[model samples]
Target: MEFGLWEKYYIEILDDFGFSREGDEESAKLLDEILSTEGCLTLNDLGEIVGFSDKYIVFGAGPSIKEHISMLKENYDLKDYVLVAADGATTAMIEQKIVPDIVATDLDGNIDDILLANLRGANIVIHAHGDNIERIASLTSFFNNVLGTTQAQPIGTLYNFGGFTDGDRAIFLAVALGASEITLAGMDFGDIVTKYSRPNISNALEEADDFKKKKLRYAEKFTNWVAENENVEIINLKE
Candidate 1:
């Protein structure tokens, strides 16, 4: 998506979360410099990998991810579609021995699982934001290859795929890559947050705090907007 088009939502997100636009820009600059070093995948490289696939399934961290994938596995041949996992959803997919083609994360999820997937040949789509500057510094060095992105602005090799939460952002990435058909899985946007969504919770379900719920709502809204504006077909497994 164009920076001009995505700017409004970026500003709204900043206001909603009381986040810093300058801080986001700084983080993006950090990530851009890091990814521009030498061997990291450029935006074109990411597009090349994702561009070949016509259909995509983006897995969110909602509770039903495992079950949904399991059911799909039994009925359909998943090789036809590109698989993208959103942050902590990597754990669920890894546990099921399903290595996704791409994993989009802000580095807040289980680092070990994310690295393990990277080692096992998954392309990491790493995002930079206000809070994760140190994370982008310390952790990005471990990855062999990464597709860097930012919500703020495009700088160097960084891109603005145009969504907020990891789940919606993954969808945006797919859209940017020319996916004609996109399927949503384990993307419940309701009030209850699962352990997979929250990352390593002892309890199965937890009540989402106001901010968390609001983010989910925005995720849903953005997906809908993209579906309409981009004219991509949406297969909502949630419904």
Candidate 2:
């Protein structure tokens, strides 16, 4: 995505949600400050891992995921597809013994489970932003394989592949890696709040539900943009 479009979306997010962009920049700076002993994983490296499968299943932390997990397990064979989970959904998937091939997170949800998944050989794509810079420093070294990301700008090791939240970013990642087909599960953009959402993680956001819903709306918009612009086929499992 072009920097101009990124700037456009940044302003849109701010206007729509009534938040400051300063935090996002601060988070990126913090991520830059926190050095990792392990070398950075480039987009080429991620592409190599993702290019193995043309089909992909991206799991969001929406409550509907709980409803579909049994059906997905019994009816759908996931062996032919690459499985990706957004942050908190990692724990939900792991609880059912389904380990994702990639976990896209801002470290706002459950870091321990994501770390466990990393230990279990799942690729971790950690997003750096203002709210969770401290979390990044505390957990970055524990994972053997990690890809850095930032919403502000790509500085040094941190890259911007586009998309704001983890769910939408997961879709952007699939597109970036050249997946031919991308299927979504638990990506509900409704008013119902899921337990995995960061609103439950922190009390800093005063209007949590409004904030979460707005983010979800933007996520849907961003992912839809990826679908419209790219050749990739995206299907909502709920549909």
Candidate 3:
């Protein structure tokens, strides 16, 4: 979608969902800073990192992630592939000593590990939102000064949860990074796993069910968007 259209859609969705659009604005600013930073990697740089011009693997924190890590490791080499980890997956990946090429997070839940990864020479890509603009700005400064420059500079992707689903930023950023093939793992958008903890609400299970349904719907929309806008391929590891 065009930038203007996307922005309008995002505002409408936020109003409908009772979510604040401030976070989206903050995300946009963060992205702007990253893109304008000196010696920083831009979307074009990301495209080159993955080779093939564009291809990526998005790792979600769903229970199914554990099952496919080995398969992904055995089948795909990380030499020139972008690995986008969602939220808390950074911790799990760290435990396995599997450093993601790029980590995406919204400064929620256990953000320290991401900082640690940056210290250890891992490229971090923080997600920015309007509500957390100050925090995101702080992080950008910290990385720029403390992390020390390397061949691979850390990045920040601004996300406006405007008209998109919760995790759609992960998919969109992966594509923006020039991923021609985007594979998904640990995206339990169907709630097919029984061993996982659902987010807490008055009706947690019911909420999870609804969240799963919405995720699936978003995934379908994402697939269609990719097919029409870019020649990117969407592969669902759950199937």
Best by lDDT: 1
Tens-place lDDT per residue, model 3, 188-224, is: 6654422222333344133346655655566556556
Q: Per-residue lDDT tens digits of candidate 1, residues 153-181?
A: 78888888799999999999898888899
Model 1 has an lDDT value of: 0.88
Predicted model with the maximum TM-score:
1
TM-score for each model: 0.96, 0.90, 0.70
Each candidate: what lDDT?
Answer: 0.88, 0.81, 0.57
* Alpha-carbon deviation at 194 in model 1, angstroms: 1.8
Error of 1 at 210 (Å): 1.1
* Candidate 1, pairs of clashing residues: none
Clashes of each: 0, 2, 10
Q: Is 1 or 3 the stronger prediction by TM-score?
A: 1
User: Which residue runs of candidate 3 sit more than 4 Å off their true CA positions?
Assistant: 26-40, 48-53, 144-166, 191-220, 227-229
Write down the TM-score for model 3: 0.70
For residues 51-104, could you state the per-residue lDDT of candidate 2 as single tens digits? 778899999988688776777898889888889999988988988999899999
Better of 1 and 3 by lDDT: 1
